[model samples]
Target: MDQNEIQFSYRARDDRGVFEVVPRVDGTPLTDLIDKFETDAGMRPSGDAYGGLVPQFFRFGPMEDHFHGRLGDAKTPLLGCECGEWGCWPLLARITTTDDLVIWDAFEQPHRPARDYTGFGPFRFDRHRYDDALGKLSRAVDEGS
Candidate 1:
């Protein structure tokens, strides 16, 4: 570990390896953990990787089903919203291993050791950060070729 590469931390549901075997938090063994995390956090997964588990956290009996902003404009980045609502949202992570997790923000900025998010959970990750991370991953994959 370099003295400079900060340890970005967050409290994810730790579903990195159960994609093919484990059942979801509910009886539905088919729910995608990612989608569950997003829906529960009141956000949307930025990828086409949802649809199966997009309803467990939703589908309540019409309490004015409000729609949070979607990731509009494929060419643009949708970082945190202008709304000030906060909660225990899940932090999306690109984990290298069980002990090596990186929580990225929409701007591609990782958590700093000196970060003072004293009220938020381990961290609060959103879509824009995921897009930035996807960009980084694409670059790495391209370079490896």
Candidate 2:
């Protein structure tokens, strides 16, 4: 491995072969991989794909259920909400294998290792977070135009 390169391995649910989460210096491999599964052609497989999972990072608390319902309807997983887009909610990640074993919040920004979060799941949402998420989701679902 190049001294500058970092990688992690997980078994994929699809024929994509053994999944290795790698952050490329030239671009974002994780995002690209997610995009493939999230596309219409791939049909967005369940488990760890973008739409397959719920948003764990939120500000003020977890969003409400209606938000989640809308989230379930969302085509893209890990979407950046108003809070997330502005960098209020920390970006987190969870890694899992076919056996259901998980490495919670395992990813980090290739450049910013000091930050508490970097990428998507192992989801670790607390009660307060969930409540807040549900509230936000409700607003998003009900109030969103």
Best by TM-score: 2
**In candidate 2, what are the lDDT values of residues 1-145, reduced to their tens digit?**
1112222222232432222122221234444544443353333232233211222322323233322323342221233212223133222343221232212344432223453432333333333434443444445423322
> What 10-residue stretch in candidate 1 is worst by lDDT?
78-87
Q: Pick the candidate with the highest lDDT.
A: 2
Candidate 2 lDDT: 0.31
TM-score to native of every candidate shown: 0.18, 0.23
- How many residue pairs clash per model? 3, 25
- State each model's CA lDDT, in order: 0.25, 0.31
Model 2 residue 43 lDDT? 34
The reply for model 2, stretches above 4 Å from the true place, is 1-120
lDDT of 1 by residue, 23-138 (tens): 12222321243344445544433222322211123232211111111222111111111121111122222212122332322321122223222332222234354334445433
